[model samples]
Target: MQSLDERCLRYLAEAVGCGSVRAAADKLNVNASAVSRQIVQMEGQLATPLIERHRRGVRATPAGSLLLDYYRRQASDREDILAKLTELKGLRRGHIDVVLGEGFVGDLMSGLLQGFWARHPDLTMTLDLAATNDVVRRVVEDEAHLGLVYNPPPEPRLRTHLAMPHPIRLLVRADHPLAAHPGPVRLADLAGHRLGTMHPAYGIRQIIAAAERAEGVRLDPVLITGSIGVLKQFVASGIGVTLLPAFCAAQEISAGSLVALPLADPGLDGVEAQIVTRLGRQLSPAAGTLLQHLARGMAGEARSGTRRSSSSR
Candidate 1:
């Protein structure tokens, strides 16, 4: 068997990263023809076409994507190893990517991440705040080292690490009629209520949809908004009612601006604030350390019980 040169693989990686043979060649300070010829050579050696060129750019074929995945992970592992060796010499530096949901963006994640950075000034971290499903996909695809997600989508490629047990609660203004309702409220009772919610892509939204389906009822939320802050604001203004993770509305509930009510029938028995990562992707040392910190932070929150409603407690 002929061994492949590490340089050719690196060149292919650069081309894949740039999405252009010419751009990769320019970046490598080589001729575009050379890059093209090398790509052809690589395809012939692999016995498959790696990329499909288009007017706009190029895209990897399925086989190409699979090879890229292995190649990228190898590269990432090599970099991680070097970073660890550098840390031994007091050079401690590397980059990590994290994707989080919107609800965590303003408060929950902000302080934690800032503190993490302060503690490890040499490590570079990039936080990408996105919708729940997007965050899940990023983690599964190895695009992110870790993900802070809520009501995560079902995927076999990722594993959920419990961050905080965030119980889902019904939110309404302090003076709203539902706030004064006597006993445990049922899903049937909320059938026609004005419910503010995020887009369909959100995990919480999916949870709600699942419950509705389980109950065989159709819920017509009066107002559907994408932002959590906006939904809270609307709830505070006595606009509508919606289910939110208790932690997300902790401050408002404590301030008496919003009422957090527990749903009796299904309850939030399985509701969770999760840390997601690729099931088999190797974590860099820094990333592993940071993930451990994140788990600890979430454990603290769970212990504090400030995020869960009294009924849930």
Candidate 2:
């Protein structure tokens, strides 16, 4: 818990994130009137309105953005001080907040989290699973120490540390017809077959759409979902075939339950998985340690993927 003034700042940040006073109050476990009063008092203290209220909800004014930046810096500075103190005590205590894309929340994350906790027994950690854009936003806002994203966009405020170009692969059941192919699958081969995939907002979906266009074929999908797990289930049930990054189905691929056929398209190969951090912010010792671990883990996944693919023959 923070001091009263700091708590007020937290309320402001939450309000900005939520975009509603009532929603922020619900999250903060306080009455809406109290939350409104705190904001009003903060406005008075600063001699300016930090947020502009509208019928839809509220948004930060110029002053609010500035204050939020200062607040984030203060929170970061506190962490840095604690990191130094922990270093003086032999790195016995630290904490890091990481935001990851939903695709990363499965076995890969479980293994990473388990290994990290075991490796750093005295350190605490927080993990948030969100959409790709949300993960990027959290890191850019300084709310998260690190972010893992798929096909990240150009953001001047953020810097990519590890860009792993994970070529999209065709994911299908072991008994599926595509499984007969010994090498990479081309886009035109699937023109008449049913396809299952995520919505267009996802990077994978965008990649698939572009591939379909270049192949000059249009196959209406049998299933269009927002969850990769759902797509995997549908594919398992013989509903349709789908495209996924190698890491997305690593467990099944390794177990021989699912087959990942490489996509032999030039455009599809540019889709990348990246780890990112804020441009000028040097991560604390704890965060920096985890970032390196994650990078190594991802690289290991890629290498193991090559070994698995080659041995499957």
Candidate 3:
């Protein structure tokens, strides 16, 4: 027997998703009648009515919903197989999609990917900068090949590797009053201090908030911005002090451009960086090689004290 074509499976899946034959046809750029006939034929082959019709639209029957899920999974598996085959050609080509959190796009990801590019010059990479939840969602849905996230997502279909742990610290200009503080600073010490941080949606923000709450302190941030780079600039200009990962503060701290001090008591222990992908997503040959390179880099960083945690690979 001949195998089912991808287009047919795709049509069925889309029809189920849209719940209307006409809508699926529009999405697929085909005639409504064609989608209708194909779905009817598919149902006939299965010997069941796959959908329930209504005046406004159609909805998938129990059987239709199951079939749609199966089709989608099969499509994802087929793509993985194709990606693997392409890698075996040793051509070092094909795009790798990465979803990363805001601050992650800077030093860590930049350094790791720079080395990767040097080795696989022909491979293309696309990075999507977003919040942690967004990154995990993309990876879980197989919309991205890999994800760099601060917080691990809890999903049975996903696996995570601890790439590194970033030692987070409070940063300020050299002349900031807190820069001269000697011992463990109490959270109450920051009562009137101008705090700058990311939106509460980011994991780091939650970590910061929890620390403050534990000390019975409530911060009145003078600035709340999403961009870490911009926050660094604000701190450098003496606008306000902010907490940031050490790696992100490295260059400025080394250049005498900023002073990063560890917060005492509930110190910014660090943010855990994780590499997440679908549990069984077959990586392309190039992707596999890059993953190994990243693992090595993480190991090296951990050894050098540049990163806080060892590889959880």
Point out where model 2 deviates above 4 Å: 1-8, 29-31, 41-49, 105-111, 181-188, 216-219, 307-313
| Full-model lDDT for every candidate | 0.78, 0.82, 0.74
* lDDT, model 2: 0.82
Q: Model 2 compared with the native: what TM-score?
A: 0.84
RMSD after CA superposition, every candidate: 3.7, 3.7, 5.3
State TM-scores per candidate: 0.81, 0.84, 0.77
Candidate 2 has which clashing residue pairs, if any?
A: none
Steric collisions counted per model: 0, 0, 0
lDDT at residue 42 of model 1 (Cα atoms): 78
Best by lDDT: 2
User: Which pairs, if any, clash in model 1?
Assistant: none
lDDT of 2 at 3: 35
Instruction: For candidate 2, write residues 15-114 as lDDT tens digits.
Output: 8879999999999899999888888888887788999989989999999998888788788878877787677776588888988876787645658777
lDDT of 1 by residue, 123-142 (tens): 88888878888898778767
Cα shift from native, residue 185, model 2 (Å): 3.6
